[model samples]
Structures are given as C-alpha cells and as structure tokens.
Target: MTVTVRDFRPADAEAWVRVRRAALPYMVTTPGQVLYDLARAHPGRRYRLLVAEEDGEVTGTAQVGLSHDSPVPGQGFCNVYTDPERLGRGAGSLLVARAEEYLAEAGARSVYTWVPDEPADRAFAVKRGYEPRRPAHFLHLDLANGTLPPLRDAPPEVELRSAADFADDPRPLFEADAEATADEPSDTPAELADYDDWLATTWHRPGFDRALTSVVLVDGEVAAFSAATTDGLTRYGTAMTGTRRAFRGRGLAKLAKNDSLHRARAAGYTDAYTGNDAGNDPMLAVNTWFGYTVCATEVRHVRTLV
Candidate 1:
C-alpha cells in the first residue's frame, strides 16, 4: 500500500489522537486537543500537524513547528509517531522527510525530534541524520490503585489552593509558571514573557484542569504549583511541577503534587502521567516517592537543517 502525507483536516482529529495515543499511551490526548492546537497555533510558530495515511487508514502523525517561544531563532521540532501495529510501511520516513522539508522552507536552521530509546527507534533517527542529545522518561502512577501520600496541613505561614481560585485573575499563576518553567531542562529554552500569549496557549489549552491543579502559597504569595492537564476521561497528566527559587528546600513541590494526585483520584482519574529529564534527580525522587515508575523513555535528537 502507498503512504501519503498531508496537512491535518478537522476530520482527522479522531484518527490523529488515536494514532498518537497508540504510540505514546502515557501522554494524554483527545480529539478536542487536536483541533484546539491547530486552531490556536501561533502564526509565528508556523505549526503544522501532518498525518500519513495508507489505504485511507491513518498510519502515522507528526507535529512540526518552530520553537517560537525560544530566544534563539531558527529552532524547530518534529515529533513523529507511527502506529505500533503498522510499522515498516514507510509512513514514518515519509512523514519525517515532509516535516523536515517544511521546517527548512520555514527558515529553520536546526530541527529537533524525540525518538524512543529502543534500539530500532534510535537507529531510525540516527540513520536520518539526527544526533542523540538529552533523555527524558515518562512516569506513570496508577491513580486508582496506587497509594498517595497523606495530604499535609499547611503551616500558619503557608496555604494550599486550587488554580481555579484564580479564575478571575490568572496572571499570578502565569508568573509562577513562567518562573518555574525558566529553569526546566530542555533542548530549546523558553522565555515566557507575553502574558496574553501564555493565556491563549498554556492556560486555555483544552485539557487544562484548573480545579485539579494545586498551588502552594507562602504568606499568600504563589510559591509552588503542580499544573494539571486531563482528557475529559480517566487520564491525568502533570503538566508542570516546580517551586520558586525562594521556596526551594521546603518540600513544597512534593506537597503540591501530592495534593493534586489525591484530588485526582477522588475525581475518578485512574492514570497519572508525568515526564522528567533523566538527570533531574530532585524531581525524579519526588515522583518515586509518589509511586510513579518509569513507563517510557525518549531521547532528544537534533539535526542541522541549514
């Protein structure tokens, strides 16, 4: 069967999510997310969602875009995934080739991609001229069966709140998120400077569950938080968990995340997923303490497109 790659149509949302969930089960995705992403994608980013179809059946998908938030220019990413059951059919190769061409035409000097750590996956990327870089792992917690740490009472100087409390005003949450995200480990560093952009992209993301997101306040100031994104179903993913600079060493990260997990279980979410760079020991220990085990690993790879 011949494989063809083309721009994503609204009709392909369901199939796109199906292919992605099959390839990356730990990541939460839904048809709403697929449409929302394409609708709200920034023009500067030149984002494109491409899919490979064989005999009218979607066999692969790729999210190709520039890292518009990064300070450095010409940074691009192509996250490609093929249906596990439909391998060796040239879907992945065609998708990668088309995505790379799109990035090059968009003036990207370098393109990065995530390839699973498995031997064949790594070999596929290396053969396509991608050089391995940092490694990251997805951790899963069986929320319905796993035991979460007992929620601790906040001290007199500290308080815990849900992100929904700031529905009328989310700038503080954005500030806290920006501060925490600045120190995140990544191949392309992001600078979250524009509040309006963050509002449209991060805060308004379709799956964002403000009520399930937990925030820790030190004397009424945002100190740490665990942002959450959920599929309207049973899957829950920790979007980001971090403590501000001054709030470090107080265990606020663990406290906030635990509170979120406990609430998630109560809300009927059965699976919890989070990702961390392999070298981030502090966050890894925190996840381990919560009974999250590594479920998948993906290595970051980069190729010069100039």
Candidate 2:
C-alpha cells in the first residue's frame, strides 16, 4: 500500500472534510467552509492544505501555515489528521513530513501541532522529534439531554441581544472579539488589527451562527459575547466567549454563554463542544457551571525547522 502526499484539490473537499471531522470531532467543519478557507486565506499566512492518498483513496489531511497574524515572528503551525480506521498505514507520517517541509520552505522557524493526549497520538509526535508543551481541554455538553442553567436576571442596565441585531455594523462586535481574543491564553498571541480580514474570514464563515450568538449590552455598549459556530445540523461549538476588559468579574460572560447554549439546544443541536487552555480557570469555571465535561485533551507540540 503506497501512501502519497500532495496538495489538496477542490474536488477533494468531501473526503478532506470527512477525514478532519473523523479525527477531530471537537471542531465544526464543512466542505464549503474548507473551500472558503483555502481561497480566502491571508496572503501573509502562507497557508497550504495537503492530503494523503493510499491506492486512490484519501485517508489523511494537513493544514500548514505560518503564524502571520501573530505579533511574534518565526512561528508556524501544521495540524495533521488521518481517518481513524486508516491509522498505522504510514499516511499520517507521510502527511506530517510534507507539512513540515512546506512550512520550513516558507521561512518558519518553529512548527506547532496539537496532539491528542491519548497514548498513540503522543507517541507519534514524540517519534517525530516534537516536544510536549501546554495542554488544552475539549469539553462536551449534551445539549439535547443535559440541563442548562436558567438564565439569571441581567443587571438593570444590561440587555441581552443577538449578534444579528448588529448586522448593519458589526464593528462593535469585532471590537469585543478583539479585546477578548487578546486576553486569551495561548502559545501564540493574536493581534486582530484588521477589521476587513475579520469580516472576510470570521464574520462570513459558513458555520458562524449569528442568530444564536448572544451578546450582552450594558447601557447600549457591547460588554460581553459568546460567538456560536454550527454545522447547520446536530453539531454546535463555542467559537469564542469573552468579556471586555472593563466587564471582568461581572458574570456577563457566563450570561452570554448560557443564553447561547439554550438557544442552540432549542435549535435542535445535540452535541456541543468547546476548547480552553488548561490554565484558564475563569472560562473553565463558566463551562463547568453549564455542566460541560472534559471529553478529550490535546497538548501543543512544537519543533524547530532549523
């Protein structure tokens, strides 16, 4: 069985999406979103999608790119996934090799990848010279069966609204997202300086459910928000849940997330997922309040391209 790696083609959308969803069930993805990402990637990102085929069947996929948006330079990322049933057939290793080569050529000094905390996945990264770093947790909530916290009364000056209400001008939503993202704990820090790029890659993404995204307004200003992403079916994810700097410790983030989850369950989504840095106690506490349990853990692994 010969496994070959090559650049992803438009026709490989379905198979690629299948492989990714199978390997990483915690994230939301679709064929159209996959294609859009490939076509709309930032020029500075140097992004590339690769696929591994064995005997004419695609079994593995990889997303390789530089951390162009990060304030820190020389950082890159390469995430690889293989069909669970096709593991150990050399497809994963082949995809990783190709991804590293591409990233190295694109002037990346360090390549970071996420490896499941499971034994085999960790072994694979270790064998490839990658070292373990900070860990992240993927939490799951059975929206269909799990009981969500009742919506508490908002502060007298606070009002709950949907992201859709700001369709005419989402700059305020973007500002809230930027502030919250800047405070997120991660190995790579993001600087959301461009409104146009955010509009193209985030606001317009296929799975983003603006109607379900809950926002808290304090006296007519954005205070906290929980962004929602879905597959237009049974799957739902919390793309981002954050409170602006001034709103910290006010419990507005929790209110927004709770409202979003209730809305999602009402919309018939069965599975809900979210990820958080292990060290983020505040968000972790919020999720726990909603009965979210740790479904899986993944550690960030990095290797220098030198």
Candidate 3:
C-alpha cells in the first residue's frame, strides 16, 4: 500500500492523537487539543496540520507553519512524527516533502524541526538537509505517587495565586510571560508582542487549567508563573514556567511550579510532564529538584531553503 499526505480534517483528530502519542508520549495531547489548535490557530501563524495515511490508516502527522511571530521573517517550521508501528512506509519523508513545499510557497527562507536525539534520527535529518542546532529534553514526574516538596510559605511581600484570579485582566501574566520568553533560549526567538494573539492561541487554549496554574506575586505584581494543561484524567502538563528578570535568583519559579504540581496531584492527575532546553540549567535544576527525570531528548535542526 502507498502512503499519502493531505491536510488534516476535523474527523482525523483521533488518529492524529494516536500517532502523536505513540511517537512522542512525553508530549501529552488529546483529540480535543488537536482540533482546538487547528481551528483556533492565529491567522498570522499560517498553521496547517498535515496527516499521512496508508491504506486507510494514519501513519504520521506533521505541524507545518510559518513562524510569523518570529522576530526574523521568512522562518518556517515542520515537525514530523511517525507512528512506531508504521515505519519504512515513507510517511515521514512524504510529510516533510509536502511541508517544505508549502512553506516555500508561503515565503519561508528557512525551516526548523526537532529531530529525536538518536543516530538514525540525526541521519534522517541530515539526509533531508537539516543541520543540528540545539538540544532539548522532555521530562516526566509521577505526580500521583512521587513525593512533592512540602508547601512552603511565601514571604509577606510574596503571595501565591491562580491564573483564574486574573480572569478579568491577564495582561500582567502576559507581561511576565513575554519578558521571560524574550530571554528564553531558542533556535528562532519569537516576541509575544500581540496581546490579542496570545489570548487566542495560548490563554484561551483548550485544557488550559487556570485553577491549576500557579502565579507568584511580589508587591502585588506577577513575579513568576507556572501555567498548566491537563487531559482531565491522569496526565498533567506544564505549558510554561518562568520568572521575571528581576526575580530570577529568588527561587520564585520553584515556588510557582511546586504549588501548581501539588494542585494537579490533588486534582487526581498522576503523570506530569515538562520540557527544557539542555542548556537551561536553572529550569532543569528546578525540575530535577521536583523529581522530574529526563524521559526523552530532541535536537533542534534547521535547513536553509534555496
């Protein structure tokens, strides 16, 4: 049977989740998430979810898009993942080829993707003209069984709150997030300059558990935060965790994450997952202290398009 690649349809949500989970279990996602992301994607992102099928079965999935938020224009991305059981059917190659063609048509000068940190995966990217850039890791913690650090009281000037508290005005959280993201290590940096876009693509994203998200306030301002999403069953995920520039060395990030993790466990979630750049020592140390161990690693790769 031959493999074919096409734009993802609303009905293909389940199969997309199935293949993504099989290929990258550490990145927790669901059918609803896939649909919400596809439907609500920011217009500037030019996001397209592609699915590869073979003989009526989904063999792989790819997220192809132009990074319009990127500070550098003409940048694109295509992250491809194939089901482990569907290898050697050319699903990955087909997806990448199609993705590249779309990106070029969309005015992209370079494309980026994350390749699993393995010899074969590296070889695959090299064969496709991708050059390794940086490394990142997916981490896991047994939220239901692992012992989380005992909750500690914050200083009188510092207080803990949930993202729900900012329901009327999430701009503060957005400000802190933007500042933190500005300094975050990445192959292609993005500036969260548009508040409306953030509200659509991130703050309002499905499964974003505001009640489980912990925010640290210092002097009545958002100093740090730990945003979260859950499958509403057993898997919990850290969407992002960061502290403001002035609060970097104050251990506020740990305070934010610990509070969120405790809330998640109490909410009946058993598995917690997060990711960090290999060079992000401070964040990695925070995760390590919280019992998160490296579950998987992927290297960022980039290829210039002629």
Residues 1-306 of candidate 2 have per-residue lDDT tens digits of 899999999999999989988999888899989999999899999989999999999999999998888999989999999999999999989889988888888889999999999999999999999999999999999998899999789889999999999999999999999999998899988989999989989999889999999999999999999999999999999999999999888899999999999999999999999999999998998999999999889999998888
Query: Which runs of model 3 end up more than 4 angstroms from their true locations?
Result: none
For every model shown, what is its TM-score relative to the native structure? Answer: 0.99, 0.98, 0.99
Q: Give the per-residue lDDT of model 3 (tens digit) for 1-306.
A: 989999999999999999999999998798988999888888878899999999999999999999888889999999999999988789999999999999999999999999999898899999999999999999999987799999999999999999999999999999998998989999899899999989987889888999999999999989999999998889999989999988889999999999999989988999999999999998999999999999999999999999
Q: lDDT per residue, candidate 1, 1-306, as tens digits?
A: 799999999999999989998999989998998898889988889999999999999989999999999999999999999999998999999999999999999999999999999999999999999999999999999999888889888889999999999999999899989998899988898989889888888889999999999999999999999999999789999999989998899999999999999999999999999999998999999999999999999999999985
| Alpha carbon lDDT of each predicted model | 0.94, 0.93, 0.94
- For all candidates, the clash counts are 0, 0, 0
User: What lDDT is reached at residue 177 by model 1?
Assistant: 90
Lowest summed lDDT across 10 adjacent residues in model 1 is found at 145-154
Sliding window of 10 residues with minimal summed lDDT for model 2: 98-107
Candidate ordering by TM-score (highest first): 1, 3, 2
Q: Return the lDDT, model 3, position 218.
A: 96
Candidate 1: pairs in clash: none
